[model samples]
Target: MIKKEWILQKALEQFNERGYSEVGVRELARMLEISPGNLSYHFSKKEDILIALLEQFSARNSSFYEHYLTLSPTNAHFLELMEKIFNSQYEYRGVYIGNQYVRTELQSQDRFDYQSIATKRASTFQKIFQGLDAAGQLRVNGEDIAFLVAHITLFGRFWISEATLFTKFPDKNKTIRHYLFLLAKQLSLFATEQGKKSIEEFSRGMS
Candidate 1:
Protein backbone atom coordinates (compact mmCIF):
# COMPACT_ATOMS: atom_id res chain seq x y z
CA MET A 1 0.00 0.00 0.00
CA ILE A 2 1.10 3.56 -0.52
CA LYS A 3 2.32 5.45 2.56
CA LYS A 4 -0.81 7.59 2.92
CA GLU A 5 -3.20 4.69 2.54
CA TRP A 6 -1.07 2.51 4.78
CA ILE A 7 -1.08 5.19 7.42
CA LEU A 8 -4.86 5.47 7.34
CA GLN A 9 -5.30 1.69 7.57
CA LYS A 10 -2.91 1.28 10.49
CA ALA A 11 -4.20 4.41 12.14
CA LEU A 12 -7.75 3.02 11.99
CA GLU A 13 -6.59 -0.18 13.62
CA GLN A 14 -4.82 1.73 16.38
CA PHE A 15 -7.77 4.03 16.97
CA ASN A 16 -10.16 1.07 17.12
CA GLU A 17 -7.96 -0.90 19.49
CA ARG A 18 -7.13 2.18 21.54
CA GLY A 19 -9.52 5.11 21.90
CA TYR A 20 -9.01 8.12 19.65
CA SER A 21 -7.86 10.36 22.47
CA GLU A 22 -5.30 7.74 23.45
CA VAL A 23 -3.71 7.71 20.00
CA GLY A 24 -1.75 10.71 18.78
CA VAL A 25 0.13 11.54 15.60
CA ARG A 26 3.38 10.54 17.32
CA GLU A 27 1.90 7.20 18.39
CA LEU A 28 0.51 6.62 14.93
CA ALA A 29 3.93 7.36 13.39
CA ARG A 30 5.52 4.91 15.79
CA MET A 31 2.88 2.32 14.99
CA LEU A 32 3.56 2.84 11.30
CA GLU A 33 7.34 2.81 11.94
CA ILE A 34 7.79 6.17 10.25
CA SER A 35 9.10 9.53 11.41
CA PRO A 36 6.72 12.23 12.62
CA GLY A 37 7.70 14.46 9.69
CA ASN A 38 7.00 11.69 7.23
CA LEU A 39 3.54 11.08 8.71
CA SER A 40 2.98 14.81 8.93
CA TYR A 41 3.49 15.11 5.20
CA HIS A 42 0.31 13.07 4.74
CA PHE A 43 -1.65 14.29 7.80
CA SER A 44 -0.42 17.40 9.55
CA LYS A 45 -2.54 16.65 12.62
CA LYS A 46 -4.30 13.69 14.22
CA GLU A 47 -7.69 15.25 13.39
CA ASP A 48 -6.72 15.27 9.71
CA ILE A 49 -6.19 11.51 9.86
CA LEU A 50 -9.56 11.16 11.62
CA ILE A 51 -11.29 13.25 8.97
CA ALA A 52 -9.85 11.00 6.29
CA LEU A 53 -11.05 7.90 8.13
CA LEU A 54 -14.54 9.40 8.49
CA GLU A 55 -14.60 10.12 4.79
CA GLN A 56 -13.63 6.55 4.04
CA PHE A 57 -16.34 5.35 6.39
CA SER A 58 -18.96 7.47 4.64
CA ALA A 59 -17.81 6.24 1.23
CA ARG A 60 -18.03 2.62 2.30
CA ASN A 61 -21.59 3.15 3.57
CA SER A 62 -22.59 4.72 0.29
CA SER A 63 -21.18 1.73 -1.55
CA PHE A 64 -23.19 -0.63 0.65
CA TYR A 65 -26.39 1.28 0.00
CA GLU A 66 -25.71 1.38 -3.73
CA HIS A 67 -25.10 -2.34 -3.87
CA TYR A 68 -28.17 -3.13 -1.79
CA LEU A 69 -30.35 -1.00 -4.01
CA THR A 70 -29.59 -3.31 -6.92
CA LEU A 71 -30.68 -6.43 -5.04
CA SER A 72 -34.26 -7.60 -4.59
CA PRO A 73 -35.99 -5.90 -1.70
CA THR A 74 -36.64 -8.93 0.47
CA ASN A 75 -36.42 -9.18 4.22
CA ALA A 76 -33.43 -11.46 3.84
CA HIS A 77 -31.65 -8.92 1.65
CA PHE A 78 -32.48 -6.15 4.08
CA LEU A 79 -31.05 -8.14 6.97
CA GLU A 80 -27.97 -8.91 4.96
CA LEU A 81 -27.48 -5.26 4.12
CA MET A 82 -27.87 -4.39 7.80
CA GLU A 83 -25.28 -7.01 8.74
CA LYS A 84 -22.81 -5.45 6.32
CA ILE A 85 -23.54 -2.06 7.83
CA PHE A 86 -23.01 -3.29 11.39
CA ASN A 87 -19.71 -4.85 10.41
CA SER A 88 -18.56 -1.66 8.79
CA GLN A 89 -19.48 0.30 11.87
CA TYR A 90 -17.54 -2.17 13.99
CA GLU A 91 -14.52 -1.85 11.72
CA TYR A 92 -14.47 1.90 12.27
CA ARG A 93 -15.82 1.73 15.81
CA GLY A 94 -13.38 4.18 17.31
CA VAL A 95 -15.34 6.99 15.76
CA TYR A 96 -18.50 5.91 17.55
CA ILE A 97 -16.74 5.03 20.78
CA GLY A 98 -14.97 8.35 20.97
CA ASN A 99 -17.58 10.43 19.21
CA GLN A 100 -17.46 13.20 21.82
CA TYR A 101 -13.82 13.89 21.09
CA VAL A 102 -14.35 13.42 17.40
CA ARG A 103 -17.30 15.82 17.33
CA THR A 104 -15.38 18.49 19.16
CA GLU A 105 -12.37 18.15 16.88
CA LEU A 106 -14.26 18.22 13.61
CA GLN A 107 -17.22 20.41 14.58
CA SER A 108 -15.61 23.57 13.24
CA GLN A 109 -14.15 21.97 10.12
CA ASP A 110 -15.91 22.79 6.85
CA ARG A 111 -14.82 19.57 5.21
CA PHE A 112 -16.95 17.24 7.38
CA ASP A 113 -20.56 17.83 8.30
CA TYR A 114 -21.59 15.14 10.76
CA GLN A 115 -25.21 16.27 10.96
CA SER A 116 -25.63 16.21 7.21
CA ILE A 117 -24.18 12.70 7.04
CA ALA A 118 -26.61 11.54 9.76
CA THR A 119 -29.59 13.11 8.02
CA LYS A 120 -28.67 11.38 4.77
CA ARG A 121 -28.34 8.05 6.57
CA ALA A 122 -31.77 8.40 8.15
CA SER A 123 -33.21 9.28 4.77
CA THR A 124 -31.70 6.16 3.27
CA PHE A 125 -33.27 4.02 5.96
CA GLN A 126 -36.60 5.69 5.35
CA LYS A 127 -36.32 4.86 1.68
CA ILE A 128 -35.53 1.23 2.39
CA PHE A 129 -38.41 0.94 4.83
CA GLN A 130 -40.77 2.44 2.29
CA GLY A 131 -39.55 -0.05 -0.25
CA LEU A 132 -40.19 -2.90 2.14
CA ASP A 133 -43.65 -1.58 2.89
CA ALA A 134 -44.47 -1.31 -0.78
CA ALA A 135 -43.24 -4.85 -1.32
CA GLY A 136 -45.78 -6.10 1.26
CA GLN A 137 -43.05 -7.15 3.68
CA LEU A 138 -43.63 -4.45 6.27
CA ARG A 139 -46.96 -3.26 7.69
CA VAL A 140 -45.97 0.21 8.83
CA ASN A 141 -47.66 3.54 8.17
CA GLY A 142 -45.83 6.77 7.33
CA GLU A 143 -45.68 8.10 10.86
CA ASP A 144 -44.59 4.76 12.29
CA ILE A 145 -42.01 4.43 9.58
CA ALA A 146 -40.58 7.78 10.50
CA PHE A 147 -40.39 6.76 14.14
CA LEU A 148 -38.81 3.43 13.22
CA VAL A 149 -36.23 5.13 11.04
CA ALA A 150 -35.26 7.42 13.87
CA HIS A 151 -34.84 4.52 16.26
CA ILE A 152 -32.83 2.48 13.77
CA THR A 153 -30.57 5.36 12.80
CA LEU A 154 -29.89 6.29 16.41
CA PHE A 155 -29.32 2.66 17.36
CA GLY A 156 -26.90 2.02 14.52
CA ARG A 157 -24.89 5.17 15.18
CA PHE A 158 -24.33 4.70 18.91
CA TRP A 159 -24.68 0.98 19.66
CA ILE A 160 -20.93 0.69 20.08
CA SER A 161 -20.87 3.18 22.90
CA GLU A 162 -23.78 1.40 24.56
CA ALA A 163 -21.98 -1.92 24.25
CA THR A 164 -18.88 -0.53 25.93
CA LEU A 165 -20.95 0.69 28.85
CA PHE A 166 -22.94 -2.51 29.37
CA THR A 167 -20.22 -5.09 28.85
CA LYS A 168 -16.92 -5.35 30.67
CA PHE A 169 -15.26 -6.54 27.48
CA PRO A 170 -17.43 -6.44 24.40
CA ASP A 171 -16.72 -9.28 22.00
CA LYS A 172 -17.33 -8.07 18.49
CA ASN A 173 -19.41 -11.00 17.26
CA LYS A 174 -21.47 -11.20 20.42
CA THR A 175 -22.13 -7.48 20.56
CA ILE A 176 -23.09 -7.50 16.90
CA ARG A 177 -25.43 -10.42 17.37
CA HIS A 178 -27.08 -8.84 20.38
CA TYR A 179 -27.76 -5.57 18.60
CA LEU A 180 -28.75 -7.33 15.37
CA PHE A 181 -31.27 -9.42 17.26
CA LEU A 182 -32.72 -6.24 18.69
CA LEU A 183 -32.96 -4.78 15.22
CA ALA A 184 -34.62 -7.89 13.86
CA LYS A 185 -37.06 -7.78 16.71
CA GLN A 186 -37.85 -4.19 15.92
CA LEU A 187 -38.60 -5.08 12.31
CA SER A 188 -40.56 -8.15 13.30
CA LEU A 189 -42.89 -5.87 15.24
CA PHE A 190 -44.33 -4.58 11.97
CA ALA A 191 -43.28 -7.34 9.61
CA THR A 192 -45.75 -9.29 7.51
CA GLU A 193 -46.02 -13.02 7.97
CA GLN A 194 -43.56 -13.69 5.18
CA GLY A 195 -41.24 -11.02 6.48
CA LYS A 196 -41.31 -12.53 9.95
CA LYS A 197 -40.44 -15.91 8.50
CA SER A 198 -37.51 -14.41 6.63
CA ILE A 199 -36.23 -12.72 9.76
CA GLU A 200 -36.55 -15.97 11.68
CA GLU A 201 -34.62 -17.79 9.02
CA PHE A 202 -31.90 -15.15 9.03
CA SER A 203 -31.69 -15.33 12.82
CA ARG A 204 -31.34 -19.10 12.66
CA GLY A 205 -28.63 -18.81 10.05
CA MET A 206 -26.73 -16.44 12.30
CA SER A 207 -26.94 -18.87 15.19
Candidate 2:
Protein backbone atom coordinates (compact mmCIF):
# COMPACT_ATOMS: atom_id res chain seq x y z
CA MET A 1 0.00 0.00 0.00
CA ILE A 2 2.79 2.39 0.83
CA LYS A 3 4.40 1.53 -2.47
CA LYS A 4 1.18 2.47 -4.18
CA GLU A 5 1.26 5.83 -2.42
CA TRP A 6 4.84 6.36 -3.57
CA ILE A 7 3.71 5.60 -7.05
CA LEU A 8 1.05 8.25 -6.85
CA GLN A 9 3.43 10.75 -5.28
CA LYS A 10 5.98 10.26 -8.01
CA ALA A 11 3.28 10.53 -10.60
CA LEU A 12 2.31 13.92 -9.24
CA GLU A 13 5.91 15.05 -9.36
CA GLN A 14 6.09 13.98 -12.98
CA PHE A 15 2.85 15.73 -13.80
CA ASN A 16 4.18 18.84 -12.15
CA GLU A 17 7.44 18.41 -14.05
CA ARG A 18 5.57 17.65 -17.21
CA GLY A 19 2.13 19.11 -17.86
CA TYR A 20 -1.30 17.54 -17.42
CA SER A 21 -1.81 17.75 -21.20
CA GLU A 22 1.55 16.16 -21.94
CA VAL A 23 1.11 13.35 -19.42
CA GLY A 24 -1.41 10.55 -19.48
CA VAL A 25 -2.56 7.62 -17.33
CA ARG A 26 -0.76 4.96 -19.31
CA GLU A 27 2.49 6.92 -19.24
CA LEU A 28 2.20 7.48 -15.49
CA ALA A 29 1.47 3.84 -14.88
CA ARG A 30 4.42 2.94 -17.06
CA MET A 31 6.67 5.23 -15.02
CA LEU A 32 5.51 3.41 -11.89
CA GLU A 33 5.66 -0.02 -13.45
CA ILE A 34 2.00 -0.52 -12.65
CA SER A 35 -1.00 -1.44 -14.78
CA PRO A 36 -3.49 1.20 -15.89
CA GLY A 37 -6.30 -0.29 -13.85
CA ASN A 38 -4.25 -0.14 -10.66
CA LEU A 39 -3.33 3.48 -11.29
CA SER A 40 -6.97 4.32 -12.03
CA TYR A 41 -7.98 2.84 -8.71
CA HIS A 42 -5.85 5.46 -7.03
CA PHE A 43 -6.61 8.39 -9.38
CA SER A 44 -9.70 8.07 -11.52
CA LYS A 45 -8.71 10.88 -13.85
CA LYS A 46 -5.64 12.82 -14.83
CA GLU A 47 -7.28 15.86 -13.31
CA ASP A 48 -7.57 14.01 -10.01
CA ILE A 49 -3.82 13.47 -10.04
CA LEU A 50 -3.25 17.15 -10.81
CA ILE A 51 -5.36 18.16 -7.82
CA ALA A 52 -3.24 15.96 -5.63
CA LEU A 53 -0.09 17.52 -7.03
CA LEU A 54 -1.28 21.06 -6.42
CA GLU A 55 -2.52 20.19 -2.93
CA GLN A 56 0.85 18.80 -1.93
CA PHE A 57 2.69 21.67 -3.60
CA SER A 58 0.48 24.23 -1.87
CA ALA A 59 0.96 22.73 1.57
CA ARG A 60 4.72 22.54 1.22
CA ASN A 61 5.09 26.08 -0.16
CA SER A 62 2.76 27.52 2.49
CA SER A 63 4.76 25.93 5.27
CA PHE A 64 8.12 27.01 3.87
CA TYR A 65 7.16 30.66 3.33
CA GLU A 66 5.55 30.89 6.80
CA HIS A 67 8.60 29.48 8.53
CA TYR A 68 10.98 31.82 6.71
CA LEU A 69 8.79 34.82 7.40
CA THR A 70 9.07 34.03 11.12
CA LEU A 71 12.85 34.07 10.92
CA SER A 72 13.05 37.83 10.39
CA PRO A 73 12.70 38.50 6.69
CA THR A 74 15.12 40.94 5.19
CA ASN A 75 15.97 41.99 1.67
CA ALA A 76 18.63 39.32 1.27
CA HIS A 77 16.26 36.68 2.59
CA PHE A 78 13.62 38.03 0.27
CA LEU A 79 16.02 37.75 -2.66
CA GLU A 80 16.81 34.19 -1.74
CA LEU A 81 13.12 33.43 -1.54
CA MET A 82 12.57 34.93 -4.95
CA GLU A 83 15.37 32.87 -6.42
CA LYS A 84 14.02 29.69 -4.91
CA ILE A 85 10.51 30.37 -6.18
CA PHE A 86 11.86 31.17 -9.62
CA ASN A 87 13.78 27.92 -9.82
CA SER A 88 10.63 25.96 -9.07
CA GLN A 89 8.03 27.97 -10.91
CA TYR A 90 9.66 29.66 -13.88
CA GLU A 91 13.05 28.12 -14.26
CA TYR A 92 13.87 26.42 -17.51
CA ARG A 93 12.62 22.82 -17.58
CA GLY A 94 10.41 23.32 -14.54
CA VAL A 95 6.98 21.72 -14.75
CA TYR A 96 5.23 23.61 -11.95
CA ILE A 97 5.12 26.89 -13.84
CA GLY A 98 4.58 25.10 -17.11
CA ASN A 99 1.61 23.24 -15.76
CA GLN A 100 0.25 26.50 -14.41
CA TYR A 101 0.62 28.15 -17.81
CA VAL A 102 -1.13 25.27 -19.52
CA ARG A 103 -3.92 25.31 -16.98
CA THR A 104 -4.57 28.96 -17.67
CA GLU A 105 -4.90 28.18 -21.36
CA LEU A 106 -7.49 25.54 -20.68
CA GLN A 107 -11.00 26.89 -20.16
CA SER A 108 -12.19 23.80 -18.32
CA GLN A 109 -12.38 24.87 -14.69
CA ASP A 110 -12.05 21.44 -13.14
CA ARG A 111 -8.70 20.68 -14.78
CA PHE A 112 -6.64 22.84 -12.47
CA ASP A 113 -6.51 24.56 -9.09
CA TYR A 114 -5.61 27.84 -10.76
CA GLN A 115 -7.09 30.39 -8.39
CA SER A 116 -6.59 28.46 -5.17
CA ILE A 117 -2.93 27.70 -5.80
CA ALA A 118 -2.23 31.23 -6.97
CA THR A 119 -4.11 32.69 -4.00
CA LYS A 120 -2.12 30.67 -1.49
CA ARG A 121 1.13 31.94 -2.99
CA ALA A 122 -0.14 35.51 -3.12
CA SER A 123 -1.28 35.31 0.49
CA THR A 124 2.18 34.26 1.55
CA PHE A 125 3.54 37.33 -0.20
CA GLN A 126 0.95 39.40 1.63
CA LYS A 127 2.17 38.06 4.95
CA ILE A 128 5.79 38.80 4.16
CA PHE A 129 5.01 42.34 3.09
CA GLN A 130 2.90 42.87 6.20
CA GLY A 131 5.77 41.70 8.36
CA LEU A 132 8.14 44.11 6.69
CA ASP A 133 5.65 46.93 7.20
CA ALA A 134 5.25 46.15 10.91
CA ALA A 135 8.99 46.05 11.40
CA GLY A 136 9.27 49.60 10.05
CA GLN A 137 11.66 48.23 7.49
CA LEU A 138 9.53 48.54 4.43
CA ARG A 139 9.81 51.68 2.32
CA VAL A 140 6.84 50.82 0.14
CA ASN A 141 3.23 50.38 1.15
CA GLY A 142 2.43 46.78 1.92
CA GLU A 143 -0.45 46.42 -0.54
CA ASP A 144 1.27 47.97 -3.51
CA ILE A 145 4.62 46.45 -2.64
CA ALA A 146 3.15 43.00 -2.37
CA PHE A 147 1.45 43.37 -5.70
CA LEU A 148 4.65 44.57 -7.34
CA VAL A 149 6.84 41.87 -5.88
CA ALA A 150 4.39 39.16 -6.87
CA HIS A 151 4.32 40.26 -10.48
CA ILE A 152 8.06 40.90 -10.59
CA THR A 153 8.75 37.44 -9.30
CA LEU A 154 6.35 35.90 -11.79
CA PHE A 155 7.72 37.94 -14.67
CA GLY A 156 11.28 37.04 -13.81
CA ARG A 157 10.33 33.42 -13.72
CA PHE A 158 8.40 33.77 -16.92
CA TRP A 159 11.33 35.46 -18.59
CA ILE A 160 13.95 32.95 -17.54
CA SER A 161 11.66 30.12 -18.65
CA GLU A 162 12.58 30.74 -22.25
CA ALA A 163 16.12 29.48 -21.78
CA THR A 164 15.28 26.65 -24.11
CA LEU A 165 15.37 29.03 -27.00
CA PHE A 166 19.06 29.45 -26.43
CA THR A 167 19.89 25.79 -26.63
CA LYS A 168 22.59 26.40 -29.22
CA PHE A 169 24.61 28.35 -26.67
CA PRO A 170 27.44 26.37 -25.17
CA ASP A 171 26.95 27.90 -21.73
CA LYS A 172 23.26 27.32 -21.12
CA ASN A 173 23.67 27.05 -17.34
CA LYS A 174 25.71 30.23 -17.22
CA THR A 175 23.23 32.05 -19.40
CA ILE A 176 20.27 30.92 -17.34
CA ARG A 177 21.89 31.93 -14.05
CA HIS A 178 22.81 35.31 -15.47
CA TYR A 179 19.21 35.97 -16.41
CA LEU A 180 17.90 34.60 -13.12
CA PHE A 181 20.25 36.76 -11.08
CA LEU A 182 19.25 39.82 -13.06
CA LEU A 183 15.64 39.06 -12.28
CA ALA A 184 16.45 38.52 -8.60
CA LYS A 185 17.78 42.05 -8.46
CA GLN A 186 14.26 43.29 -9.02
CA LEU A 187 13.74 42.81 -5.27
CA SER A 188 14.74 46.44 -4.94
CA LEU A 189 11.95 47.60 -7.19
CA PHE A 190 10.28 49.79 -4.57
CA ALA A 191 12.92 50.48 -1.94
CA THR A 192 14.20 53.94 -1.13
CA GLU A 193 17.93 54.64 -0.69
CA GLN A 194 17.48 54.31 3.10
CA GLY A 195 15.27 51.30 2.72
CA LYS A 196 17.76 49.92 0.23
CA LYS A 197 20.62 50.51 2.67
CA SER A 198 18.71 48.75 5.40
CA ILE A 199 18.18 45.81 3.11
CA GLU A 200 21.90 45.70 2.35
CA GLU A 201 22.59 45.63 6.08
CA PHE A 202 20.45 42.55 6.41
CA SER A 203 22.65 40.66 3.97
CA ARG A 204 25.04 40.00 6.85
CA GLY A 205 22.33 38.08 8.67
CA MET A 206 21.35 36.15 5.53
CA SER A 207 24.70 34.42 5.05
Maximum-TM-score candidate: 1
Q: Candidate 2 — which pairs collide? A: none
lDDT of 2 by residue, 1-207 (tens): 536458656875674466456777898888888888888888887666656655555565566676677687565566656545545443223235444544554346565555666676667777777666666556567567667657765764455446544442235345545554564355456665655666565444433
lDDT of each: 0.84, 0.59
For each candidate in turn, the TM-score is: 0.93, 0.69
Consecutive 10-residue window with the lowest summed lDDT within model 1: 95-104
Error of 1 at 202 (Å): 1.1
